[model samples]
Target: MFFSFWNSVVFIIICLILFIRFDTSDSGANNLHLFDANNAAEMFGNDVFFEILDPEVLRYTYRARPAKDFGVTFNETFYQREALLVPVEPPDSCGWPKNAHEIEGNIALVERGDCSFLSKTIRAQEVGAIAVIIADRRLVVDDDFYIEMIDDKTERTPQIPAAFLLGINGHMIRKTLKELDMRYAVVNIPLNITFVSFHEMNQPPWMIW
Candidate 1:
């Protein structure tokens, strides 16, 4: 009887340990490196950012500005999503995507122009992109100010998130992918911006200050 009681006790202990470990891992998965508002303002200025979490060599945070009048807005509730950043086939994404199979369940990186911002987002949304990042074709994106992605007066609005990226940053991302022969890059979007100092934040090595 004593031996049976001991066995039951041991089983309970083992179950408890497993449960604790699982809970810890789940919590850790949701936690991300945070940056204070001062850090965010200094580093990205008016832009928000996303982090490249995979291909350790390409791990860096890039600047972006969320659209004002369309799609879901970024907030605590909309944070903590990880997705593959895949470039559209036509780049502009004016028409239906040729690589819809690859774009589905991922974020589409479409070039700005050739269509209204709304149209580009709609095309990506139709193919099941969780979000869209419109990259400017010009070298400078309005001198660090966000170019408003106004409503195109379309009857339907995109249901997913959309943001604008600077041409230089976008070109670098595409160039790096091509050089590495990678089809897509793993990314964590809409990272929570805290009020921590830039020095305390987990800054990528490639970024200068």
Candidate 2:
């Protein structure tokens, strides 16, 4: 009995050591913590990626965190949508966008600020946007960093799905559009990169590894 107990304890200690090593491994670090490949989809709120398809100059993928309480929650297993990524006039989208005509029937890319995330999403929805992607206004050095876009405390609820994109990724996308004198970029939102290996991902050139 004593020998069996000792063996069990030794096995548990080995398992713990292996788990710790795997958790902090180099490959794990590259997968981004919020969407770690080894973790379950529910562990990270079923996070997803936005993949640019048109204007080859900007064909890359970026992470997005979908809202938990409003609209449709993205499913990593099967959810996917292709749409034109249009920028809202006045950018902040605190009020209705002047480019409502352009915003209608496409994904509105609004800058983060001047209003709650839900407010921005609602403004885009009013213009007939199928979905909303609110990009961070301030750029953080960490490429994997992003904000959890939660709903605002109000009776007015948006009916469309929304997600948050990192500031640097947002800036790069907008800058590419400006340089190309374009109004929108064709994109596949919430592209499932859950099982995709880090090296196989079509990550932007600016993204490190």
Candidate 3:
């Protein structure tokens, strides 16, 4: 049940999504609409924090604008690999283990810095990772609090999918390891994305609570 993170968790993000199951015209539509808004309304607020089951740290799930047919219907559970919090050396080099045997066939949770997104992913993939989750280690901007990641922007896209979680969540993961008597965690993450209006998201911050 152990998923490695930076010195990291099994990172099971059980992404709970009930908004799409109910119809907009249905009685629950009013409430379910709010569910939709919470997950997808990054401009107003980013997705809520999810609990990791085993090594137990808060997880952040992310969604991206789908591009045509290539779009993944995040409604399905995706990336169920046992999370391996792969280590990054100082000066920001990923693939610290360097040995593929240690990380083959698992999701590598890597913190963002010291290298291009491609290098981190490509190295992990070369070793044998099923997917990659890039956790931000620093706050570069307000949006850094959200699940965000950028591809290399090359003509070629990775065979695997890579996404980001906020820096706050990353710190939480680290804290859990230091304070708790745990080794790592495993997670199942489901993704949800929907359109949100500025008006719906403009309520007072207290009202959001």
Candidate 4:
């Protein structure tokens, strides 16, 4: 029994030493890093912004990505009325809504499935929506959805500001669609929208010690 206990102690000591050695080297914790500016040139010219769509005292900060043709970094604070999710049919998954006329000068709320994000945003833009909000399909996207980078290489970027909304916030706005007629209510059916820019457009999350 004594021999067995001594062997276990030695094994643990060796493990601790190995762990400390590896952790201090390149192959261990030191190798982990944040994903900042993977391709410098590609992301250097782009600008990420924040959108304030809330009317209450608490304003939610939503990251905004500009389309390729969106041009240089600029900030604007404006209000837009949000509308219901449009239905996309077969033959290219392009969406259309019955109230397309109402969306002309308003923001379009589209679900994050059934079609490509660009397709949804393009449809909303074609119908004359100033901005498109792609709601996260999952009830609550645990990670930061805004950190995702938009690839506008092959596919053409949507002209209107295409913003992604996490499930919780997106669903809340979606729920207001049911009360479209209740204009005076706290949340507007076609909710007011705002777009503003900030620094640090391509900073990635840190994943190391």
Encode model 1's per-residue lDDT on 107-156: one tens digit a residue.
99988888898899899999999889988765545453547777888777
Model 3, span 19-92: residue lDDT tens: 43444357677657656544435543433222254553334332222111211322334535345553322213
- Write model 4 residue lDDT over 60-170, tens digit each, in one string: 433333433431222344333333233222213255766677667666656666666677767887888666655654555666334442543556655567655433555
TM-score of each: 0.71, 0.73, 0.52, 0.46
Give the runs in model 2 whose Cα sits over 4 Å from its true position. 1-45, 76-82, 139-146
* Candidate number of the best TM-score: 2
Which RMSD does model 3 reach against the true structure? 20.9
Scanning candidate 1 in windows of ten residues, the lowest lDDT window is 30-39
What lDDT is reached at residue 59 by model 2? 87
Q: Which stretches of candidate 3 lie above 4 Å from their native place?
A: 1-51, 56-100, 139-148, 153-156, 178-183, 191-209
Better of 1 and 3 by lDDT: 1
Per-model lDDT? 0.77, 0.77, 0.47, 0.47
| Backbone atom clashes (below 3 Å) for every candidate | 5, 0, 15, 3
Per-residue error (Å), model 1, residue 199:
4.4
